[model samples]
Target: MQLPLPPSPMALPLSGRFPAPFLPPSMRKAGLLHPIASASLSPTIKDETIDWVEATSNFFEKDTRPIMLFDGVCNLCNGGVRFVRANDRNRRIRLEALQSDAGKKLLRRSGRAPDDISSVVLVEKDRSYIKSEAVLRIMEYLELPFPQLALFLQFVPLFVRNIVYDNIADNRYTLFGRSESCEI
Candidate 1:
């Protein structure tokens, strides 16, 4: 006999669209649409807390591109990367799948537990940010009103913000599906 498939996860209501200020004119004209690919820059984490600062410092010495560390196998993460790439004006971001060696090195340096890879990370200079904070920081650097949203998120309570972010992250695979290979 065949086993039944697991129930699909529930989807949260599509909350209001990102404020008009955040949407690019082209995207606004086209209406809300999911992006296929995007770019993201890593956040700056404090250097003093990380152990492998030397490695990171060496890697970044010659590279000026902003690095983005994300869950390589997550479809939702890949989509976000694509959206950022589309909106980036100066092309400042660089993508790095968290599963890659570079990503692992970055994580080790930051003193974060290995399992913390589940969240998106942004590494810049000697600083880093994770979860909702990372998301807000990234939006701030993007073109247009998206940066405005980051400013608004600052007023939100950390616990409340993280709770919502966690729910979406935990159920992302069920809602958006996943890929066998990393998106790169």
Candidate 2:
């Protein structure tokens, strides 16, 4: 008899890699294992405003600088973090690897799965941004020219910017490679 081939990582759903309990509650509700939704609010949240300060009161009480959560083992992500650290001379931004305890805590507090590392996450005092929005927001802390460029890019349609962001994110590991461990 021939041995059966194991399913590839891509073939497995997000829930397959993690136990049901580890998956987010929303994913568990429908018994579905899909990618995590955008870091923004869900469609059903149209009316009520979330008082994030009260929700995450203890977490952000002391430090209000934006915190960037990035993939620890991704070379491109690590390089991006390094770039921000070097350019943000005023210490305007804070950094954390998604795999860290602090990062996981923030992810949970932000209503994201602890294992969700598909996109960069930026947590400001009152709100959080992800993917392209996070990247552009982070740019505001960089040196002059980049900040100016970021302001200009703000006019671009979110869908258009996210299209570019998604393409790059999808190909990041293949294009920029992965690291054995987080550099910073």
Candidate 3:
């Protein structure tokens, strides 16, 4: 007989409250999370508590370049990734599709649900950034004008920036279309 899958540790509790902020037991045991600064850093699971910053640090090895995780099937996201790859002469940033195994793992390791692909995720320097911040950070690695433009845009308030970002993100599939499969 086929065996049933175990319930996910991330499932909502019986009380109907939101799930706790902690790595799923499977993830915690798999050692997917690595501390950037110390070899001895380990999660304390007392009462299922977790140190989010420590848990999310250095998901990829320190030697690897910054990773930009995008929606694989979204045309706009794919285009954005291609543009970054073409413009990043030094290859300072690495791109991963949210549909990829590595991307899903990184997302989970960063305390986000793997299926929550609404925002682009930028993981760099032992930290994860999302939405407008992630886009702005990615610009820093692109050639000319973009870095300067990103710096200038940073002067805008975060709420206002995110409002624009969220509108684009929410309607990207309708605007730029989507691929039947991941483009790259």
TM-score of each: 0.69, 0.69, 0.68
lDDT of 1 at 63: 81
Question: How would you order the candidates by lDDT, starting with the best?
Answer: 2, 3, 1
What lDDT is reached at residue 107 by model 2? Answer: 63
What is the per-residue lDDT of model 1 for residues 52-139, given as tens digits with 9 covering 90 to 100? 6665677679786657788888899989988888888787777788888888776655444344567787777656667887788788
lDDT of 2 at 52: 29
Given candidate 2, what's the lDDT at residue 79?
92
Candidate 2 local lDDT, 1-184, one digit each (tens) = 3333433321122221221123445666986543332223344332234542355556567877878999999999999988998899999998999999888766655555667888898877656677877888899889988889999998998789889999999999999999999877
User: lDDT per model, in order?
Assistant: 0.66, 0.71, 0.71
| Candidate 2 Cα lDDT to native | 0.71
